[model samples]
Target: RPVCHTKPQPGNRESVGCLYSCAQCSLGGVLIAMDTAPWALDEKPEHEEVCEFRPYTCPCPGATCKWHGSLEAVMPHLMHAHKSITTLQGEDIVFLATDINLPGAVDWVMMQSCFSHHFMLVLEKQEKYEGHQQFFAVVLLIGTRKQAENFAYRLELNGNRRRLTWEATPRSIHDGVAAAILNSDCLVFDTSIAHLFADNGNLGINVTISMC
Candidate 1:
């Protein structure tokens, strides 16, 4: 008698490809392909089917529901909403420009002397940096040589001993004081003076002097 083979049902749908058996004259059977399409002659049953869609959720705080096409889309949301922002560029240093108008024509001698006295006190105190140091240096340089010399002597004497000292002479104190202020890390000069000088042609000499 010839035996007939039964077709597999949905419950046994583990194999999606076509199946074939030997001639009815023999009981021997073999799987042509383990996992292949039905169109190939050596094809076997497919164990798993391809999924059409996969569900996902938004990475937002409220567990917002949304389908993201890729992980790239999620990155921006995390960065703008969750990640901290930073800048690659460094901070800029601003310089103040001042205009000094005089009633009468002023000679370089007078300007230099005035600036030396004004900047000498500032250079004595080594607390501030940046705007303070820059402005003081500019003013001192513009003043007379005698004033610069006097300021210099004062700075050397003051810094010489553990006790602070002042000199009555006129000398350029620019180099010594500048060196001290620049070397000290904690020292920071007032920046407001720049705004004051820029707004008004008159130098904020009193403000700068008081800071020293």
Candidate 2:
């Protein structure tokens, strides 16, 4: 006996053809036949603001120059307009000595002393993080021990006023003594008075005196 078989046909318009034959057809070839569709922008998609385009401001005092909104623009202006200052790293201490060439400006001397003390305080704060062994102390000596003592007293007063506390270290005292001796403007001066003490096992401070 012979058997008869009939090919399956789509009963409805929505019916898809057999999967086995359709699987053999290339999807890329079909896509090429249907041309690339145009993108519609009738209701344009919104984009988030880029953080890079935000305005940048500089902290340099009395600077009016404004260009591209970024720190890159302000840095060059700062370097060119203002003098370059050194930043000490890794437990560095700096002492500054000022000489009184102009007489009777006691207020100015007091102000300078206050400034020097503040600088030392900042160094001491950094020392806490870097380790006490890596700390640097600077003392600025003006004319005589009396003068230096006066400044020291002022520093103590300021500390009391601000309620600031600092750890007392031998290195700090040594730097203070050295600065007092080296900071002089007079042509006739004694170099023997200034003293420097290094608390660390190693001595590595480079001291330079500028007499003008």
Candidate 3:
């Protein structure tokens, strides 16, 4: 129901026939598009891609979560339903996931708050094949993709005299982390390497976020 509405021309006295120079979003953000049709603003890829008012789904580490709502409701939902998720402050922190060798699908979720924003860090382990286990670590911003573009994140695993690291921009909650996981765009490792980085069945990852 977040439709776009047209704006009147500077000197226009009548509503109809006025140049549809801009479209106002329901969230009170004005999108200026002189040559674009006001009716087409709803489907405009540029607008739709970064519009903060768009509906967003839960970015929790699992696919079973079906909650979806406006961007503003994300934090409240995360706080209430994901009460077990750990929250850490600062741009650099260590996310320690206990029992990395746990069998079957497992997810370790944590929230990182810095620079007046919330970031979700997810570490998941799953058996992608019959006998091979894969680990994925990714960071997601609890904001619009436009806002997410302003930040970048880094994930590092250090142990056994070796280090593995991945650095990239944080994906927006709207964008989700599924595609990144499917494409292996995040920090990925196999069970063997996971054990190499695990200390007493726990894995500690150095996570850092910064403005870009």
User: Please, what is the whole-model Cα lDDT of each candidate in the order they appear?
Assistant: 0.28, 0.25, 0.81
| Pairs that collide, model 3 | none
What number of clashing residue pairs does each candidate have, in the order they appear? 18, 3, 0
In model 3, the runs with Cα more than 4 Å from the true position are: 1-53
lDDT of 3 at 209: 99
Q: What tens-digit string does per-residue lDDT give for candidate 2 at 1-212? A: 10112233334223222211112123211211111111211122111111223343333212243433343444354346433323232223332323322222111111112322321221111122232222222323323223334343211111112321122221222123223223321111111111122222222222222221
Q: Alpha-carbon error at 58 in model 1, in Å?
A: 68
Model 1 TM-score (2 dp): 0.19
State the displacement of the C-alpha of residue 56, model 2, in Å, after optimal TM-score superposition.
1.6
Q: Which runs in model 1 stand beyond 4 Å of their true positions? A: 1-111, 114-181, 184-188, 196-198, 206-212
After the best TM-score superposition of candidate 2, give how far the Cα of residue 31 lies from its true spot, in angstroms.
37
lDDT of 1 by residue, 1-212 (tens): 11123343534524342334433223225333333223332332222211112211232212233434332343344345544322111111112223433322121111212332322223222124323332232222213334344332221111113222222333222222334335542123233433333345533222121111
1 versus 3: better TM-score goes to:
3
- Highest TM-score against the true fold, candidate: 3
lDDT of 3 by residue, 1-212 (tens): 22345463455433232122223245334334334444544455344454555578899967688898888899999899878888999999999999988889999999999999999999989876768789989999999888999999999999867999999999888878777788888899998998898999999999999998
The pairs that clash in candidate 2 are 139-175, 139-176, 141-180
